[model samples]
Each structure stands twice: as structure tokens, then as C-alpha cells.
Target chain A: AQSVTQLDSQVPVFEEAPVELRCNYSSSVSVYLFWYVQYPNQGLQLLLKYLSGSTLVESINGFEAEFNKSQTSFHLRKPSVHISDTAEYFCAVSRPGGYQKVTFGTGTKLQVIP
Target chain B: EAGVAQSPRYKIIEKRQSVAFWCNPISGHATLYWYQQILGQGPKLLIQFQNNGVVDDSQLPKDRFSAERLKGVDSTLKIQPAKLEDSAVYLCASSLVDSGHNEQFFGPGTRLTVL
Candidate 1:
């Protein structure tokens, strides 16, 4: 079994400010990490993923996350946030084997204010 | 390419009532999943299907919750004798195959309110 922990339930930041959402996971085997964003009344959208290599993965929307093995963390970061970036963020993980189930975190709500 | 589709964006029912939700995965997708998202919480996998066969359903409440994928294309989830605690958003997601590291596409979800 695997579990994901999102340290922050909510994070508020002024427009154009940088923000980071912390996530940690526990699993007995190797895993793949991912970040997903959900806007109001919409389904989840993939932000980025860390399958292997580089340890650091980036999304086209200025979001990035680093897979830290020793720390068991995959924290999401954005250098500068906009009002449009306000949404719920989720961290997910899956085991190394093929077709393994993915487990998600409690989620962090990012509120970008003016 | 069309995204995963689910019917009845919202549903309201009384306790002990029965309700059903439908889902259509993306064409050629080999894996489909049903998840429950409680308020202020992350989505929890309720059931998973590879084609028309069950892959994982360890978290599903077999007592009152049932789901099936027919012909390996469309799927349906049903809850009998719903309870107040059953109120949550039911989400359907599809992936190429649970292989490697493919990303799953999600539907808007069916928000079920049990009174």
C-alpha cells in the first residue's frame, strides 16, 4: 500500500509571487510521481510527472516538481503565480510494476490573490 | 481526441435510494477507473478495469457499490441503498494502459448528493 501526504491544506499568495506545495509519499517499492491541477467545475489536468531520470520535471504552465528519493518528497513549485493559477493541486504516486494503481494526496488549494 | 465522458453531471437522492452513473472512456483506452472524491479530499480509487475485466477493486464497497464495463468500451457504476455518507463526486478516468507511466484523463465527475 502507498500513501501521500500534502503538508499544506491551503496556500495563499499574491499575484506574481512564488509558491510551493509540499508533498511526501510512503511506499515499499519504487514509484512514479505526478502533480495534477483542478479548476472549479472541471476535471483534473496533469501539471507534470516524474517517471525516471532528471529527478526534476517541469510543466508547460510554469509548474515544476523534483522527485527527491532520500526525502521521499515531490514538491510542486511555481516561480510566479497568476490569478488564473488559483486551483486545487494534487500529488499522486504509482508503484514501479506495470499497470499499478495510482494513489493521490489529500490535496492543496492554491489561492492566488491580487 | 475526445476526453473521458460521464453522464448526469449532478444527482440528488434520498437515503436508501438507488442511483447509477455512466462513463465512456476515450477510444482505444485500455484501462478505466472509478474514483470517489469527498469534499476537501483527494480522489480515491473505487474500482479499476482493464478492458472489460476487473483489475482492482480492493477499495470498493462491494456490499452496496457495483460497477461493470461492457464490451470494454462504456462502463456503469451503481450504488444501492445509498447512505448519507455516500455523498461525493464520482469521477471516471481513462489511460492508454496501466503500462509504463501514462497519464490518466479524468471526466468532470458526477456530483451525488444523498439527503
Candidate 2:
């Protein structure tokens, strides 16, 4: 069984400030990691994912996350944030084998103040 | 391509009443999923279907909640005798079958309020 934990429930940042959302998971087998963003009243949109190859993954919107296997962490980061970046972020993990059910963390709400 | 579609964007029903929600996945996708998202929480998978066959429904509250993906296309979810705790957003997502990368396209969820 796999479970995801997002350490922060809320994070407030001033415009142009850097921010990081911490996420950790527990799994006994290989898994796929993903980050999703949900804007107000909208469905979740994929931000990025880490399947294999590089441990670091990036999104077009200047957001990035690094998958740390040893630490069992997949933290999302952005060097600078804009007011438009305020939204909810979620971390999810899926098992490697068939019947891959993705389990998500209790999201982190990002508030970017102008 | 058109994204997933869901009907009755918002629903309010009294406890012990029944409600149903509909979903249509992206064209040609063979994998569809139903999830429940409570306020301040991430989406939790309720059930999954592969080409109209049940795949996983481990977390679904079987006694009150049921779902089906008929003909490997449109799907419907129902809750009978709803509990107040079941008030949450129900999300539907779809993905291409056998795709190495499980990138799911989601629909704007149906928000259910159990009064």
C-alpha cells in the first residue's frame, strides 16, 4: 500500500517570492509520482510527473519538483510566484504494477499576495 | 480534443435521499475513474474501470455508493441514503488505455451537498 503526506496545509507568499510545498510518500515498491494543481472551481490539472530517468521534473509554468528516493520526498518548488499562482496543489503516487490506483495527499493551498 | 464532461454541476439532497451523477470521458479513452474530494483534501479514488469492466473499487462505500461505466464510455455514480460526510466534489477522469504515462484528463467535478 502507498500513502502520500503533504506537510503543509497552507502557505502564504508575497508576489515574486520563492515557495516550496513539501510532500512525502510511503511505499514498499516502485511508484510513479505526480503533482497536480487545482484552481478555484476547476478540475485538477497535471503539473508534472516523475516516472523514470530524471529525478527532477518541471512544468511549463515555471514550477518544478524533485523526486528524492532516499528521502521518500517529492517536493514542489517555484523560484518566484505570482498572484495568479494561488491555488491548491496535490501530490499523488501510483504503484508500478497493474491495477495502479493513484493515492493523493491532503493538498496544500498556496496563497500569493500581491 | 474535448475533455471529460459531467452533468449536474451541483446537487443538494437530504440525508436518506438518493442522487446520481453522470460522466462522459474523452473520446477513445478506455480508462475512466471516479473520485471523491472533500474540502481541504485531495481527491480520493472511489472506483476505476477499464473498458467497462471493474478494475478497483477498494475505497468505495459499497453499502451506499455504487458506480458503473457501461459500454466503456459514459459512466454514472449513485449514492443511496447519503450521509452528511458524503458531501464532497465527485470528480471523473479518463486516460488512454495502456498508455505508459498515466496522464488523466479530468472533468469539472459535480459538487454534492448532503443536507
Identify the leading candidate in terms of lDDT. Answer: 1
Which candidate comes out best when scored by TM-score?
1
Error of 1 at A47 (Å): 0.9
Model 2 misplaced regions, further than 4 Å: B98-100
Using Cα atoms, each model's DockQ against the true complex is 0.72, 0.59
Model 1 scores a TM of 0.98
Candidate 2 residues B31-76, lDDT tens each?
9999999988889999999999999898999999999988889999
Worst 10 residues of 2 chain A by lDDT: A94-103
Model 1: per-residue Cα lDDT over B1-115, one tens digit each: 9999999999999999999999999999999999999998999999999999999999999999999999999999999989999999999999988863789999999999999
Question: TM-score of model 2 relative to the true fold?
Answer: 0.97
Residues A1-114 of candidate 1 have per-residue lDDT tens digits of 888999899999999999999999998888999999999999998889998899999999899999999999999999999999999999999877776889999999999999
My TM-score estimates for the predictions, one after another, are 0.98, 0.97
